[model samples]
Target: MSGFFKNAFLIAKKDLYSELRTRQVLGTMIIFSGLVILVFSFAFDPAQNTTKAVIPGVIWVIIVFSGILGLNRSFISEQRNDTMQALLISPMDPSSIYFGKLLANFTMILIVELVSVPFLFLLFDFHSIGSVGYFLLVLFLGSFGFISIGTFLAALAANSKSSEMLLPLLLFPVTSPILIGAVQATKIILSNIEKLPDAVAWMQLIGAYDVIFFVLCLILVEYVMEV
Candidate 1:
């Protein structure tokens, strides 16, 4: 167990270091997220009556799309540099690679969210959340599930000729439950119309999704990489 985590951390550190040197994945995600937020801000009128109604959907949609950009690149570097096979043949548990990649992807997307969220609040005229704690929990659960599944699909599609295109087609459908849960949970947090229990219900849904899929991905990634 210790070896599993140590190997995973090393793989994650390697990815993070590579990203820091090249700025490929993180840069694209941040820029894409910023532009999308700016465009939405301009397109939607903050003073409009429907602003709050649409804000949740817009925020989650932007997150999903921007995250796709990073997820698409998650395995591309390994393929591009011909290191996928080496990683696969390594003595470390294959789950380590998956968890490592998941960590890297999660970190990149989290950073993108942290940067763009304040801009989203400022532009959407969002003032406060009903429960800051619940809001963070929703964000964490939603992002972890999304990236876990995405990292799995990315490895599955890494060998494809049109992986860039194939990844989204494979990913979007599988991630619908996450999107639905996240958007609804976020809506509840932002609106605060419903009680804390209401948000808790959605949080439970997202948490279950995260745990189930994260475990499934960990168990199955070895077979995925083998083929």
Candidate 2:
């Protein structure tokens, strides 16, 4: 158990060091998310309170799209440099590799969300944002759903001829339940602080999805890598 965690942490640490030095994924994610917010702001010309209503949708859009960019390269970089095969044959458990990539992608998405959420509110003219703690919790749960399966699919799709296109196609259907739960939960949170109980079902759904898919993906990664 210790060895497994150590290897996973080392892999995650390597990806983190690379990101700090290169900033490729982070840069693209910010630019893409910003453009999305900018386009939506002009397209709608929303009123003051309207931003609150649309904040949930806009936030998820940025998350899923920017997450795609991150997931796309999650495995491609290793494949491109011929490092994936090397890593695969190393002494580390294959689950460690998946967990490492999952951790790295989760970290990147968190950074983007931390920066973009404020910009999202700013662009949408949405003040009076309610319950910062709950908002972050929702974000964390939603991210777990996206990132867990995303890391799994990324490994499978990155080897394909149409890997980039194939990735989103493979992802969206599986992710729909989580997205719906997340969007609705966030909407309830932002609109009415007292009505949070209404979203308990959705939060439970997100939590279940995260737990199920996380274990499923972790179990299947070894086979996926073998293929």
lDDT of 2 by residue, 1-227 (tens): 89888998988899889888999998999999999999988877668555568779999999999999999988988986589898988999889999999999999999999899899888777777577788888999999899999999999998898999999999999999999999998998888778888677788999999999999998999988873
- Per-residue alpha-carbon lDDT of candidate 1 for residues 83-155, written as tens digits (9 for 90 to 100): 9889887898999999999999999889988998888888888886777787878888899889999999999
Q: What TM-score fits each model? A: 0.96, 0.96
Each model's lDDT: 0.87, 0.90
TM-score of structure candidate 2? 0.96
Residue pairs with backbone overlap in model 2: none
Give the poorly placed runs of model 2, Cα more than 4 Å off.
Answer: none
lDDT for predicted candidate 2 compared with the true structure: 0.90
Q: Which 10-residue window of candidate 2 scores lowest in summed lDDT?
A: 43-52
The TM-score that candidate 1 achieves is 0.96
User: What does the lDDT read for residue 100 in candidate 2?
Assistant: 92
